[model samples]
Target: MEESKAGDLFAEGVVKHYEPELKKVEKQLNELTSKQSSLLKELQKENVKFSSIDITELTSLYQMMKEYHCRLIAMKKDILAAAERSEKLKNRAMKLKEYKQNIALENAHYREAQMKREQDLIGKPGQPL
Candidate 1:
């Protein structure tokens, strides 16, 4: 029981810390999504411009576009990883809560059993369990 209580406390602390960080990551993901959309549109526009322009300058621009695409992919990957970590923390917190509940229930059952044993031994008022 004590161990479970301590685990509950630790899980709560971890969950408390993780919640705000998860929100921050969510916000960052939103911002990154918007940025990615805008960049994609810009890349499309650049492609259109490239189609009409000379090849000499497009090489550098193409490199820049490729770099931008890579960055967007990396940001998406980071967001996925953050989401996974957040889910793990949430699951841990829920399990801790369940553990605490189970411990309390088991303690109650034990106490009830002890009471029953005492009643059986005492034989209440000429009666027995």
Candidate 2:
């Protein structure tokens, strides 16, 4: 119960903490993809063949693209790790809840038996034991 709530809250907080960072990474990847597409389109319009392009002129762009790709891969790994953590937390919370319910049910059965025994001793509110 309470433990589960606390665990869930903590998990949510962790997710929230990383959400913005994930979004920023995704935005950067999108921008890079768009830039790459536009660059390719411009080359096509100019009838520039890949072999005819100056490697030196495009070296920086290539480096930047590679860096962005690496960052994207790192971000993906982070997101996967976060998802695994969240799943583990959820399983823990569920187990805690199930254990709490089982304990409550056992307590209820015990209380019921106790009440029955007391009623039997009292002889059902009658005159005899």
Candidate 3:
């Protein structure tokens, strides 16, 4: 039971430690996504024609969009991995709690049975009441 409690606490700590980092990454991903959308909208407004815009400026915008896309992908992957890890830790903690509960319940049952046995012995012949 003690071990289970320790393990549960450890899992909770780990999850808590990473939770903020996970949220930060998710927030960055959302911001990046919004930026990407805005860039796309700008490009659409321009009809994406190379002849109307300076070549260098268009290329720069394209590069910036590309970089944002790459970063967004990486951040999304990071968020997914973090979420999976957090879920696993939560499951482990829950299991540990259940195990601890089972242990406590078993101990209670054992003590009850032992007390009943003592009472029976007290009523037995030649045994102290």
* lDDT top scorer: 1
Residue-pair clashes per prediction, in order, are 0, 0, 0
Clashes of 1: 0
**What TM-score, over all chains together, does every model reach?**
0.44, 0.56, 0.53
Worst 10 residues of 3 by lDDT: 120-129
Worst 10 residues of 1 by lDDT: 120-129
Writing each residue's lDDT as its tens digit, candidate 2 over 5-93 gives: 99999999999999999999999999999999999999897785776888887998899999999999999999999999999999999
Tell me the whole-model lDDT of each prediction, alpha carbons only: 0.96, 0.94, 0.94
Task: State residue 21's C-alpha deviation in candidate 2, in Å.
Answer: 70
The Cα error of candidate 1 at residue 92, in Å, is 2.9
Model 2: ten consecutive residues of lowest lDDT: 120-129
**Whose TM-score is higher: candidate 1's or candidate 2's?**
2
lDDT of 3 by residue, 21-65 (tens): 999999999999999999999988778664577989988999999
Give per-residue CA lDDT, model 1, range 1-129, as digits (tens). Answer: 999999999999999989998999999999999999999999999999869897867888899999999999999999999999999999999999999999999999999999999987887795644
Clashes of 2: 0
Query: What ranges in model 1 sit over 4 Å off?
Result: 1-57, 119-129
Candidate 3 lDDT: 0.94
- Tell me the lDDT of model 2 at 77: 100
How do these models rank on TM-score, best leading?
Answer: 2, 3, 1
